[model samples]
Target: MSEQEFTKSLTYAPGLPKDATFYSGHKKRVTSHAVSEAAENALKERGVAVEDIAEIVFDLQTPFMAGLTMEACVENVRGALAKRELQHAILVGIELDKLAEKKMLSEPLQSLVDQDEGLFGVDETIALGAVSSFGSIAATTFGYLDKVKPKIIGRLDQEKHGKVNTFLDDIVCSIAADASSRLAHRVRDQEERRLPKKR
Candidate 1:
């Protein structure tokens, strides 16, 4: 058979194409409200107030992205939380930090977490995984937030706070970083859409 005839003889399966859905339906299956509530409860248990976290999120987002409102930042964070992967990361990172704070880990590991060792990079690594969801802007934003340690992040890092927030700080930073990236992408898309197209 000729190449054209051979190709025509092949039958395609009839079903939904794999690429039909850009995003997994899981994002819709999980509610952002539920995710936000769980995150708030977790933070509260660790002595960080939801309001304080919101403030920090606002601080991280506004400086880089122009005209990004506080409400938008809050919504972005809620949206990020809605991702099941991020939700799992946040819970696991927080719980691991709590365990370290309570001295629940064995010898060397406990010492690393309790002392906040410079070499102990697991916490930041875990948080980094979540940041990647939003692309390169998220990474750069996370670096800035990590360096500045603005607002609640700084408070959480201090020894006087009496709470070991090793992972919590980084996780929150990732959330804020993701939100900032989201805003940047949205604004850029809007601008692109406004531009005239060539014939």
Candidate 2:
């Protein structure tokens, strides 16, 4: 399959907001060759490709201190793809504000946010790594993944709080499955195009 052909069936779902601050991405972009190379490298390392990928889904059900869930999801998606060097990436973000309140990881998490003390709760670095991979486009509202779908998810647990993100993760997993299928078809098409032309 050829490159463009590989991307033919690559369809992306539009990102939607699960709540006020929670947002997600569902699209494919062909810009940035360097980013593409990075994705490709990452994919090679992971033994996957954008065209072969089904979807790149992530859920952010953590207690927000000063950032947006949308931003975090995008970053996680991007970081996952970049880590593998895949071609396409799809970012799915889910919200779980209720859980945050119930768990009470909010105020305490926020208190130590700026301290940089490195000892309070779960780990800010983990959260940052989870949300900054896809290149944040907005303060806490919008962002975009540098790659397309068919991306292999690198860190799932770190990306979303599975223990507390049940509902949100369920939806995200569904979204990821859809994206993965679409990406795989795209990859198949590209492979077909790569075949030599018969004269």
Highest TM-score model number? 1
Task: Report the C-alpha displacement of residue 127, candidate 1, in angstroms.
Answer: 0.5
Q: Model 2 lDDT vs. the true structure?
A: 0.33
Residue 128, candidate 1: how far off, in angstroms? Answer: 0.3
Residue 19, candidate 1: Cα error in Å is: 24
Worst 10 residues of 2 by lDDT: 138-147
What are the per-residue Cα lDDT tens digits for candidate 2 across 65-137? 2232444444434444443122333111112322442554466543343232335323322223333433332
CA lDDT of each candidate? 0.74, 0.33
TM-score: model 1 vs. ground truth: 0.74
In order of listing, the candidates' clash counts read 0, 31
- lDDT tens per residue, model 1, 1-199: 3333322221234464644423332234456678767876786787765456557667765666667677776677666666666677788888878898677989988888877788888878988899888999989888888888888778777745445778888887887787777777887898999999989
Error of 1 at 171 (Å): 0.6
Residue 189 error, candidate 1, Å? 1.7
